[model samples]
Target: MKTSKGVKRRRVEKDGDAVVATKLRKEFGGLVAVSGLDLSIPKGTLYGMIGPNGSGKTTAIKMIVGRLRQTSGGARVLGEDSPLSARLADIGYMPQEMAIYTDLTVSENLQLFGSLYSMEREAYIKREEALLSMVDLSERRDSLVSQLSGGMKHRASLACAMIHDPEVLFLDEPTVGVDPELRVGFWQNFADLKARGKTIIITTHYMDEASRCDIVGMMRQGKLIAEGRPEELMERTSTSNLEDAFLEYSWRDSV
Candidate 1:
């Protein structure tokens, strides 16, 4: 029943959760990037984390994905410790920044990721083709990443993240720079993945898109201000939209 920075703490347990955290905090020097985040995401859920920039969304993901060590607390993903030495192959992460190789063609990048996963040649080719089509890069497969536009690069990065059929996905601002039309397709893709039983966590700024998530968590100043089904959050605040609901939560947290 203890609290840190006004954020509640709970026992860290997976308990059928695809991702679970308790008192998850990250500090660089005296600044706490994540004050103390308690999170629980059930398996096969499409969870969205919404917040303004630097609200610790990316930092929290980095910690959960095992890319960065946390200052305190604990997290478990897919029943394993989050900071474990080896990342489970069943996890996929799409970071906010471009992570693909700039000098390689889109097809080549896919091949590289496939090889990393030790995929068979035939399976790799099949998955690569499907991913290319999904990201709308089938026509631009030969284009070098360096030559692709920002949005195109983003699409390529997403395709690469899903290359291995990971059961858990962490997408950080995945729709940034994406066209409105393409963004709709991306949401459909996410829905399809969820239907197939994947657990997804995404950080986004678009309140409209957040409203579409199965569960939405609003974050501010490194803490979760509110969380629930999008409709429920709006209903709790008596707000008509996610934006207004989030504003109400943020104001309450600040007071």
Candidate 2:
């Protein structure tokens, strides 16, 4: 009961879209998690989706990644429909919860993901080394995930997600629990991945991180209320920061 003005939208179509959702909807008994959502993400761009907790960010990503079934409508990734198993090898996903094997050493977990993609031993090792270094976990490569601190486990999970060098990455709050310094490094890593032509979509509550993305979508009550370049959004809302812009949009949407 808050939103009022409808935000301008980008034209959404399948062509050139790395991920596309059309009239996408999801439900859980009486709760409507997502409602008629339409999203378009082009290839090789860093897109950030920001919203309050339970705003349906994770649900949207899971539907896009084919991890969850939608109650209605559809989504396509890399030109294929949902459940993109054929393209799974080309996609990377770092969920909100740690997905790495806790019983395995950092190195072993990386290797397992690499092996899943049928990566050659030499290639796997080479990539593992670089990822470990990128995540600043080289010193902890032999450390068991269960023994590592929470932040370290988060980093290891990121490394595992990127070990195969997927063309597209869906990172859900990748910087959670990370220290400021390490968070900077993670953004740098994301920048490097973007420069390498990877399509990266990240969901975060951090307004600072939203400014770093090439484009951002603001979601509220399971609906996208606004989508645009961060600066454009700020200018439109007469806001000085993304947080303000988000509030303005959410306010507009609520009425």
Q: Tell me the TM-score of each prediction against the true structure.
A: 0.93, 0.94
lDDT of every predicted structure (CA atoms): 0.91, 0.91
Q: Per-residue error at 217 for model 1, in Å?
A: 0.9
Mark the regions of model 1 whose C-alpha exceeds 4 Å error after superposition: 1-13, 85-87
Q: Write the per-residue lDDT of candidate 2 for residues 1-255, one digit (tens) a residue.
A: 554344323333346788889999999899999998998888888999999999999999999899999999999888889988799998999999978899999999988888889999999889988988888999999999999998899999988888889989999988898888989988998999899889999999999999999999999988999999999999999999999999999999989
In order, what is each prediction's RMSD in angstroms?
A: 5.1, 6.3
Per residue, candidate 1 scores C-alpha lDDT tens digits across 1-255 of 556743432333345689988899999899889989999998889999999998999999999998999999989898789874455788888999969999999999989888887889998888999989989999999999999999999999999999998899999999999999999999999999999999999999999999889999999989898999999999999999999999999999989
Instruction: Report the poorest 10 consecutive residues by lDDT, candidate 1.
Output: 5-14
Q: Output the lDDT of residue 183, model 2.
A: 92
